[model samples]
Target: MTDNRQSLADLASLTNQPAPAAPAAQSLPTSEGDIAAPVSNEPVREPMPLREQILDKQGRAYATGRRKDAVARVWVKPGTGKITINGRDQEVYFARPTLRLVINQVFGITEREGQYDVVCTVKGGGLSGQAGAVKHGISQALTRFEPVLRASVKAAGFLTRDSRVVERKKYGKAKARRSFQFSKR
Candidate 1:
């Protein structure tokens, strides 16, 4: 048995193969002090690096969200707030009264203190999606300004990324939500 074990080791070394990890002991105590064998061979993943975690946290704290080809850039500054879209005032650029309403609602701003400056640059999507993107961006920027505000923004559903998108359907379909023509003879 000793010679066989030595031969196996020599063969493994010659083949440049690593020795298999030793199996854990499997004996269990019967009303006596003993160790139980590990039940599985799965290797554990290492914990996240502290520096990476910190950077992730910082990124989340001050991040931008884009959607539907519209980009919303938000910065939180100290002062009576204001909002400018493109090079024009938000109200004039947005024009739609209802969108103004949605933006105000999403940002949780009252008529009195809508003063926080939110400068957004959006392109590609129609007016409505741009407004939604801006709302999401502002919500994220606000959370970065105050981590405690995350719950409030999340509860309002403004902080959540809108994942709804156009879906592709089968080749025979007219559109994503449409069906193929009837083939009754």
Candidate 2:
């Protein structure tokens, strides 16, 4: 009993308390079938044939576009003077006259003789996003057409994307740039 007491005191002094027994070690079968196999480090990759098409189609006009909350990129290239979007005519793809005007007037490629082909691929946002993408694409195309036009396009605010994103509203707020309901009280 005294030895037990002395040993207990020694354990308490070493461990700062009564020494608790360690948990039993988990026993595993030593058989070969129980061993786990090593996994391969190589990552799986899928073929992107469409992406090649996207890059090849527009090879020249590289654009970056961003709007309220969406951002897209468009590419345009000058070729045999034919304008097409996703293999269809630009007029048919983008039916909005305002959009077309924005493309032609702002990009300065109105002449049929100087044709601009476009290959635009936009992701995120909606119709407006797509339009912004096209605008950005055209801007890039203009820049590519002549490096001198960059300054003019930049000044016109066409090249620079409107990055003004929507501000987060506070609790009980009405809108991003608006205040809550007003009460004279």
Which pairs clash in the backbone of model 1?
Answer: 81-115, 81-116, 81-117, 82-115, 82-116, 82-117
- The Cα RMSD in angstroms, rounded to one decimal, for candidate 1 relative to the true structure is 11.4
Clashing residue pairs in candidate 2 are 61-76
Q: Weakest 10 consecutive residues, lDDT, candidate 1?
A: 51-60
TM-score for candidate 2, please give it. Answer: 0.52
lDDT of 1 by residue, 1-185 (tens): 46666676888899999654333223544456665755778888985442221113323223466666666766544456577777788789889988877666745632324546666677767888888777787777766666555666777778788987657676878887687788899
Model 2 Cα lDDT, one tens digit per residue, 1-185: 46666676788899888754332212333475875444579897875332122234536746666665555565667665455655667688679887666556654643334566566655566656666666776776657655666667777778777776557877777776677779899
TM agreement with the true structure for every prediction: 0.59, 0.52
lDDT score for candidate 1 against the true structure: 0.65
Shift in Å, residue 56, candidate 2: 8.5
Q: Model-by-model lDDT, in order? A: 0.65, 0.61
Model 2: CA > 4 A from native:
1-59, 80-88, 109-114, 177-185
Q: How many backbone clashes does candidate 1 have?
A: 6
Poorly placed runs, candidate 1 (over 4 Å): 1-62, 109-112
